[model samples]
Target: MKQLNILLTAVALLLFTQEQAHSQIKLSDIFKKVTDRQSSSATSAGAPTTSEIGLGIKEALQLGVSAGADRLSVKDGFLGNLAVKILMPPEAQKVEKTLRGIGLNSLCDNVITSLNRAAEDAAKEAKPIFISAIKQMTLTDATNILLGKTDAATEYFKRVTSAQLTEKFSPIVTTSLNKVNATKYYSDLTTQYNRLPLVKPVNTNLTAYVTQKAIDGLFIEVAKEELKIRGNINARSSTLLQKVFGYADKKKS
Candidate 1:
């Protein structure tokens, strides 16, 4: 009888211990889940939403485009800026060289100046095109742009708006070229070059060349503006910009 009573007590003690351990494990799991949920909620609360990301990216792009267009549209914008100044086409380098060789320096200078003038004129019309592209940005695009490389937004603009910009800029450039007498001067330069003894005739498309250069210059400016906004806190002008880009800054870090 004593041995049986001892065995029963031992069994009861073992079961009680097991039950306590099981309860502890269950409580531990519940606490961990609650903590996890709280942490996740905190993270989400600190992060920007999908809509805010899209709006922030759009705002940044618009500001960039406007600044870029405004800088290039002013007088001496392209002419004074060596970075974007339109010059003689590669195929016409020989022509310019030949023209300048024979006391035609004045005419060569005129051609270079007029080419930049046309580009400057065409740059004035880029803001609207860029704004339209910004308006069309999707949530996927916004997220990618925010996390992508320094020039990702600029690349996006180039990819989406290049064709439309070309279409819009061609006529404006052509008109500007004529207004500035670039066409006449180029024709005169090429004519003189072609007439030179033993020289191959060259007929480069001035309008097409100038249009592409102008587009490239605008993109360059836009890229700079984008970098400024991403890397500099002060560049975020509005409350929305600050909130959106602040979230981006945190994510990047």
Candidate 2:
């Protein structure tokens, strides 16, 4: 299945490359014809030669990081946003359902809600870390990314910032969870659930679980914002941003 998926992706990529090359050829030919006609008529009467407007690796990625982090730091950012809401994973969901089925629904619900709240609160601190990464980008970074595949910019940001962001965000998530009483809530729930009839009780780690979930949610939101800024003309907030992101926009369309 994985190999088949890879094959399909390669085919799609080839088609996209053909289309892009076709467009570039068509546009270049048109421009050359126009330039020749203008030169024959009058050199000064022609439109000025247009420079390439594509963003290099450094600029596109820096813009992506900035735009993504900006969106996350705003009011209702990750907390109130449904698209980035942190929810229980499959394993944890099973545990919750099992506890609920055995008459421990209240505890399960408390733990679930509190875990999400902690993640939402923790999401606020993501901007600084992302900004720091963006600041470190250089012209070489831009060139390398321009030659890479789709989502290359995002992948680079993940490699550089994921660990640092996790470290910075973990403590905040932990504090938020504790502040919301998620630890005690899960503890009491587990106690009651464990006491249930004929069940093998298992201890769960709430802090570690919430920490992972929170970070996952943060990255998901950041990626969405990055994709938008890279693809959508209306999302560019500055002159440099528009120029930089225009490259990605053209690459997509």
**Candidate 1, 1-253: lDDT as tens digits:** 9999999999999999999999999999999999999999877777788999999899899999999999999888898888888889999898888888899999899999999999999998999999999999999999999988999999999999999999999999999999999999999998889898999898988889999999999998999999999999999999888988888887889
Q: List, residue by residue over 1-253, the lDDT tens digit for candidate 2.
A: 9999999999999999999999999999999999998888764433211222223333445566556555555554555667765555454566677877878777877777777777666667776776677667655665455445556666777788778877877788789889989888877866765776787675766667766766666667556755675567787766656654554455546
Candidate 2 wrongly placed segments (more than 4 Å): 1-82, 102-104, 248-253
Question: Using lDDT as the measure, which candidate wins?
Answer: 1
Compute the lDDT of residue 110 as modeled in candidate 2.
74
TM-score of 2: 0.66
Ten consecutive residues with minimal summed lDDT in candidate 2?
A: 45-54
Q: How close is every model to the real structure, measured as TM-score? A: 0.80, 0.66
| Total clashing pairs for each candidate | 0, 2
In candidate 1, position 168 carries an lDDT of 93
Off by over 4 Å in 1: 1-45
Give Cα distance to truth, residue 252, candidate 2, Å.
6.8
